[model samples]
Target: MRHPLAHALRWSAVGVLTAGLMCTGLTASAVAAPGSPPDPALSTPGLPPPAPASPPAPASTTADGLALTPPMGFNNWNSTHCRAEFNETMVEGIADLLVAKGLKDAGYRYVNLDDCWALPERDADGRLVPDPVRFPHGIKAVADYVHGKGLKLGIYTSAGTKTCDTAGFPGALGHESSDARQFADWGVDYLKYDNCNNQGQDARQRYTAMRDALRATGRPIVYSICEWGQNRPWEWAPALGQLWRTTGDIGDSWGSMLSILKKNLPLAAYAGPGHWNDPDMLEVGNGGMTDTEYRTHFSMWSMMAAPLLVGSDLRKGSQATFDILGNREVIAVDQDPLGRQGTVVSSSGGRWVVVKPMKDGSRVVALFNETGGAQRIATDASALGLPGTAGYTLRDLWQHRGYNTAGTVAATVPAHGTVLLRVTADRRWAAHPPAVEPGLDGDPLAVAGRTVPLTSTAADLGRTTARQVSVSLSGPEGWTVRAASPRTARALRTGRTLRTSWELSAPPGTPTGSYGLTLRVDYRAPSGVRADSTLPVTATVVVPPPPGESFLSDLPWVSAANGFGPAERDRSNGESAAGDGHPLTVGGTVYAKGLGVHAESELAYYTGGACDRVTADVGVDDEKGGHGTVAFEILADGRRAAGTGVLTNTMPAAPLSADVSGAHVVRLVVTDGGDGIDSDHADWADARLRCRSAS
Candidate 1:
């Protein structure tokens, strides 16, 4: 099956939409409608309009008042490590710089210390204490200093038996209430709750335990969950915490950042005001990234509405670092009260653009160039579904400046760099109100149901021109309707109807699952000019499972690796840390300890080097022995090493005597030729890698 992201948008059909010479703001009349198929999202209503968002709580007063927009402040784990004790002087020094550098005034009022704060052992009362040698003033004194600087203090703890620091500080399992009370007593404003060793309990139970515990302290503490996506927290975390780390630990590398962001685009629905999808912490202002990469990091994070937990050593940053961290335009989006997180609209050839709708009716757009070479990116106003004659104002967010843009505005973004733009209408111009086509209601159909091919047939919404049309549906379950097309069109409402034109080719896959379909229209026309219009288009899509296989069992991995045979086997015993089946000669036995350990196996010509460093071609056959067995040989340059035994496809009746071949390595290969297969799964519990190595 094709990936959804790859077919979400069309590249060839892409074009620009700009205002006409005669068109001004409100005076614009012509609507150069892009041809697209009808959208189904408009007619449908999303989950009963989410409940009114709560107000922001006082950062220092409540244990759980109201959640805030963007989480503020700095985290120390990324840039430095605390040894025997957290250096109180270092913390105080950074606090001083934070105030002096104006970070506190910019809504960044929290200074979080991550781990390494406790002494080797707790006191008799099980109370965690700061190491006196490093913190002569004590933990309370440190918190007080941060508070004096007008900043809140955040601390970290594990839910496991031991902290990540390996310190003896008490964890928050059975003693959650106690830990919460202790943190409140220490004046800790934020608690970074880690999910390290507490794997037995579900995230909800573990998290809720802490949440209720903290609330019991009558302390308003922000709960940050770090489970590494093991439990898909987006489905339940918002109700318990202010911010949730949506990805794994962040490394200051372009690859790591890109992987994290791309993986997170689909989870946008779970993020909003008071609830955030954290992409770990900010790596901007850190030396690991170049100026361009740093800019990309900050822009992407802002667009994603991620928390602004600057991880750089603020006191030592250069001018470039300061500029990257102190970018107001980028920060505004992150701090927007609307709390909307941007999702990817289109991406291709490593050149992608993400558009985020802001509360102010403006848009935050980030154009990223992940290619190896610089390239230019330009978008027409029409592509944004604006009136035929529309005018736009472009604000280069990085430059902190705006420019009047018509037709197309282009920029040359460097490789691995980004262009951040805040696109809005010029205040001088009046915005055209969107026209609501009546009866619009349709959604992407599920893959299993029937499918109605979109064609030139009017009944099937075949052949089309550009006009925003809604795909409506009437079904018992409010069936879903999807487009198998190339370009990403605007989904209107309820993830059903969308803003589109007749020309939109069906998205690349087949549309299925809808019991019925119709098209509604949405455009900006004067209410009196014309009432809502309906373009009724209907058809049925029939999709069935593949021959002989149920949908679930037909998945890629299961189909490719399923049972055991002389030629193949399913080594995945569903066991933890146990190696798969052992590949041995048809009549040979593999001598080994620890019967089951999950590890990989393969068969390839052995390179004459240390076994650890040797590379294998994976699934290859051995045609040697002409049918003979070689003696077990282990030699380091023909000298003796350790193990005493012969290693070969031919097994001996008894264990061989000890012989040190001075071998720091072992090599096994087919003296004759055999078919070469790469990555053919194998097992190794009772056998050895004959023609191929098994695990």
Candidate 2:
């Protein structure tokens, strides 16, 4: 699917290193309009906007309104499986516990079923029939059982052709409208739409298709888009979903838990009241995590405003799990009606501090030490800006206690633990204080050989999007112009020299190379305001080697792989040609990740000499639920020599196969399609298809 957004950056050229000032503007959308009043409707006490509008009804009951504070719920996938004591009996038992134990009274309403609920095939009429063997009473009966208990019931499905379980149920695409109707008929309230087999389509189409499908049901199921983090969903998924997955599946291990939390901190702004950045599900009540890690997990997730989807055996939950889940003070932060995701204010090694600006004009601060040792936490009076002659109210969220504090508060946080302090006004304030000007430091930007620095200032501006600044420049003789980081068409040309112009957008992955263009300041303020200022710029370009030398020849691997080294025969050319060098020739296996391929093909090497010894170790995880395949092939002396296989257990796992000559190649082909051979266990380790000179 072609994204509506084609331009990521643009650049122009001016003469030499330094260029004069030009007009620049920051549009209204780029910057928040000055002094806009806060929207009261946006901060609900706990409920957030529904995922997005779908048939039946949009996931949200309110229209773009802020969410009610926190959401509490239990999901089954974390502990339940197709095998091992999971049946209608288990479901009923868990459901009974949810009500009898006061979890529902504690604000957890949804009893969400994860995967493996469907039968191996749809009914003859194309309607998905529940696996009668698993749930003898059917899904509707289960829904009623939960609904009678005053709790909502949630179900799951995939956007692809098959469920992640590789079971033969239909998907949302082509079947979206139908499946949605089915879910609605089943009285489903929350739809956890997953991405299993839908690899060929772009995120926009895949997500939007299901969004529309769910809406078509007229059932008002919450739309949850599960695409991992490809295409930066947080930037656009809100249009299609209420919540979007932000990372790979999280396990119930301390390392897995911490890694996921740290990865999401930089994306704090993407989360808000109605829309949330989901970090998979909560694993706190699950057994793999320690009590300390579980507490930290709940604390961090709540601070992050992440949807609290508890993934554990609630019936068997320990007292610690209940305490962690039932902490109303901590839940207040997670359910903070303001919906503001906490942001990192300070960090050092294993200890860090974060602050969430509350709608009540106060701040919620968390001092976290995720290590095995205790750390002292101190809040500077200057940083908090507490006025003299007035005391502030400090509420300990975890301890559920309130007190008065003046200047600063000090506490020692235990290892792998947190101290959450909700600082609010002791008495109702007349009005919020003026916005403070944030501090910023400027640096010299080089263009060509000139420098421009010591000039920019950063201040507080309420805007959803960041601002971009550019410079225009002219060049000297013989320097026609090479390229720009932000490719732009507007260039200032004069005589034999060309002026260079620049524009900054979101950064890309390629190393930010220094372009040889004169630089100037084109200020685009967050508020549609435009200005021009003089700034310095410099240039850094890597000069190519002499005529006789080739870039690839510089690597020692070139000699090690032999002149008979690896090289590609053909490429699928199925997607964009962004950073990849076409006609890939590998003296060795140039293995890079994130290929974004939609079809099956090969990455092969060709050497004139008859060669073999082709081996590969395949690591596969079923994130979307359906099976993924990887194949190894060996080509020697212009003929196929050997091949091997790796497949999924649920589906037939296909082995690696190839047919080429010694002079042809050795390769790896990964795809969504195959002959369906070894589909049961989709994993292979160092599986090699070796064909050497059979001298």
Candidate 3:
């Protein structure tokens, strides 16, 4: 994983702190307001250009036959990085749980150790030494313990003079051969070689040195290049390592995951057997996001054929965590023998359809929803490169169900969720019941005590007709749901639809959060065979903006990210600790209410389409004493509504205003002013939003 010092040094050298921040965590994909217009670059026709006929097999440069499929394993960095708990006991416990919890059986094998496993300095013999307190029995004993459990062991080191952590542990920069021999002697099976304090060495030469050294050991250690995509490792690293990181470290948030997905999705051509495009490790079970988001994270990783490195503390994992991790069906996609990475079939309006051609001639279709609300994402078998067969069999990998589609494949995917389906041509598909895909149409954002009208539709995509079709929508406890129209139909012919309307009302005192709603569909065939399906729906309760002007700091933000520390309210960006900032000040003036943030920061608030205008005075905080430069921009639903040219700490505050009428979410963004992020403390003084009364 990347460290702050590495990021600061890398960006300061390039004088593009903003770009570095974008890769680290504050990516454009993460800050783009939800429900925004689709990126024009990703907008394609319903049927995208077909994938190459007979895609070439990945050329293996190492010739070791290692990592034939993306490595499935556990990495300790994300869960307990450099913590006292990340010791021999924890590593052994993870190995035990991997087997006891069925993860090893489900395809996870490696139990890896990240940084901090070693002492800060090497021994008198110039060999790296394991921390005595951390691994009292030594690395070999832990490696043996892991191997005894039928799993592999991975260790981390940097290609620089020191590892990424502040501990400055000795790295393998000039010691590649010695370290490689040492690791091989210990029975280490995998090596994560990172980029940090490299002294500006050539990435290729440095990595190749290790690759040659590892090969010299006559060991089959899987090499993972963690250069953070600084040198486009995908273009050359395949010949040197089994996998290369394609992005910066991944945070446990929807924005971070989505941003990395956008970065990695374009490099599908460079990934295959024995070599992979690593998009960092998995953040599942980390708890920064909901279970739905985690499912999407896992589903996308599997779809992309990316390395599946579990980055959670499995000892404290819950049932939901195990359920997501132990999904053998999803893991199969990642381990698909074909070794083809999934590519986008079509994308528009925050909905994406990605298809991966399997060796069995089937296609894995992932209908992904990146919007702020549930959406009906769809694609047809033809679009997925399937022949014009009479029928197609669809297996919902997540739901573990079988379905038959005449041609169209679709599902109502929740916000930040994915519906993974494996579709294959099946001539006997007609023998199965009709594949009725269910969808919900309505605003997912609801006001407390308001009756929101919603419609659910079931479309038959199977070859045969369905009889006695019925649909029901149920809300969470304390909420009322009533059918507004007929919920049953006598028949639903192929390609026809049955629609049911319902009025949903949440109690006045309902809290603000996502609530679950279930849409169940029951249908029978002409021969009296019956089938039922239940689809989950999500409704978010939001508080409308107050009438009249109100300071932005008073409202709870939907999400926030900062370059150096957490965004502060009505204060100056001091240090990393919360509430440690001074009063908001810029150009020697103090403000009573404002936001203090570092460069490359973003704060979003749910406007609920009620706010019409936002006004603020933006500047680099005077606390830096003319040391920082930055720019500010405001976005309404991902569209830039207002912005300020570069501003330095020496300049007075600049008034900024934006027309945010009809915007559901308004975002405030700050970026480094070209030079770097040194002392880049920014402020939004007296920021206020004006809204109409909630009707």
* Cα shift from native, residue 453, model 2 (Å): 53
**290-350 per-residue lDDT for model 3 (tens digits):** 8988999999999999999999899989899999999999999999988888998877766
lDDT: worst 10-residue window of model 1: 17-26
Off by over 4 Å in 3: 1-59, 556-611, 614-687
Error of 1 at 174 (Å): 1.1
Model 2, backbone clash pairs (residues 3+ apart or across chains), number: 95
The best candidate by TM-score is 3
Listed per candidate, the RMSD to the true structure in angstroms reads 23.2, 22.6, 6.8
TM-score to native of every candidate shown: 0.54, 0.53, 0.84
Report the poorest 10 consecutive residues by lDDT, candidate 2. 15-24
How much does candidate 3 score in TM-score? 0.84
Error of 3 at 483 (Å): 0.9
